[model samples]
Target: MDDDRERLTSKPETSDPLPKAEHPWVETLKTIGLSVVLALGVRSFVADSRYIPSGSMLPTLQINDRLIIDKLSYRFSDPVRGDIVVFHPPAQLERELVANGEKKFQEAFIKRVIGMPGDRVEVKGGKVYINGKVLAENYLGEPPRYQWSSTELTPDGIVPPSHYLVLGDNRNNSYDSHYWGFVPQDKVIGKAILRFWPINRAGGITPQPDYNN
Candidate 1:
């Protein structure tokens, strides 16, 4: 009777063991890693944030204004006129920077598209002319203080294929297409869709100008 009771009470032995509880530190590290990966993925392929550091886009985008750049839309379609774009400096600008002793010159720029492929662009008498018609830009706080001839950037003033002419709303202050050259389609990072900083000014970026009218 005693032997039978002991055999029934004894625990069974097996090769398999119960899983050990994960260490709290290990769990924390895993969570952090996953968060970082997700953030990077979203920033690289989905959307990202940028802050304006200059007045190039002033009256439209103020200095230090935070913007959400849409990285996915241009994947399905080409950029159009009036889109506020952020892009890496073009080769021409990069070369100029290097010649001027700028060793690290991979800065990005933000500007509004003013001319598309094969479009004629010119700036004279404080007004921008596209295809010989004056561009009705009501967003400018003031008229451009400089002049840019059509042939200055390219022969015949036509924007080359896969290239875009971009300018700042603060045209005279911006070092842009008129100074360096056109931005290649591939250099564009994305378009600025919304401004989310400075509560009072927070809203979608300036509406796209109507070119058809």
Candidate 2:
């Protein structure tokens, strides 16, 4: 009877075991993967960084200058004149490259918006004109050395709907719309918002004061 009592009072040794702790390395890998995914998501839809690779935007963006590109703004509104923008090569340029037998690749180009839909753009006598009025440009490195007329560059003497004329601040040296053609609205990637590198010159890329006057 005492033995029976002892067996009744004792806990069973065959009870279920506690769950095993996960390996430390397994947890570490999970954290790393989550961080990578978050970074990629932000770059794709929120904002991203870019560095100037040439003097095309000189005096405004020097070679090797790093900038923050805002990819969200254009989704809410259309790009306006004087906004620095980055975009993919347009179809016209792609066809030319293909004709030259060059390697096919997508590269982003940076330039400032100069003409909007329905606007007439003309470059002559060291000045840019929009709709017959001379543009007030205080940021150009120097006057454009080349001449361009809307009638000569486009099918009509005005910017087509959903197209933008882009040019480099370093007008004389840039390979821009005057050389190739208009940038389709859909090809634009984003507006350049800030310069973050070369700390002495770091600041917002402010839009030029309204030149429509």
Candidate 3:
């Protein structure tokens, strides 16, 4: 009778270790599920992870400054004047032009929109004149006077009926519309919505107030 009771108590101890071996697979599945969730989150929001690559938008956006470009907002409406945009260079035009018909690779540029379709654009006394009126820009770090050529656009050069003209805030140092031309509506990727990374500079990028509309 004493031996029979001891045998029954030892049976439970052997069974308990079997379930511990099964837990590894359950933990692996949990880790995989979390990874999928993170990937989906990045795709949905404007990723708060981009860096400025050039000095074209210097006074406002600096090189190496990480930014958050909004990919959703522009889906509801077209880009407006004074909006800073990122886009691929217009096809066929290059950083350098050929003497006859040569092609060169011009990296994409970033700049602010000063004119749009159906609007006349001009620059005088370092001031931008749109539709026979002067535009007030309080964001420029310096007046644009001696750096750019006096540009005039005819009805045909006026943004191709669906395009936009853009320029850098640092006019003298930027190579923008004064060189290549207008940005095609389809080439526009997204708007620069905010500055991130540098905790001190993290904030929303307010859209330039619209006086033309």
The reply for model 2, stretches above 4 Å from the true place, is 1-20, 99-101, 104-106
Q: In model 3, where do residues sit more than 4 Å from their true spots?
A: 1-48, 95-108, 146-157, 207-213
Task: Give the TM-score (vs. native) of candidate 1.
Answer: 0.88
Backbone clashes for every candidate come to 0, 0, 1
Q: What TM-score would each prediction reach against the true structure?
A: 0.88, 0.86, 0.71
Instruction: Give a tens-digit lDDT track for model 2, residues 34-78.
Output: 999999999999999999999989888999999999999999999
For each candidate, C-alpha RMSD in Å?
Answer: 4.1, 4.6, 6.8
lDDT of candidates 1 onward, in order: 0.90, 0.90, 0.71
For model 1, how does the per-residue alpha-carbon lDDT over 12-92 read when each residue is reduced to its tens digit?
A: 786788899999999999999999999999999989999999999889999999999999999999999899999999999
Q: What would the per-residue lDDT of candidate 3 be over residues 1-213, giving only the tens digit for each residue?
A: 889989877656444345445487888998999987886676455443567777777678777877777766777889898888877777534534453354644444567987888776777788777776778887788877653332443434455577888888888878778666777877777788888767887787545834433
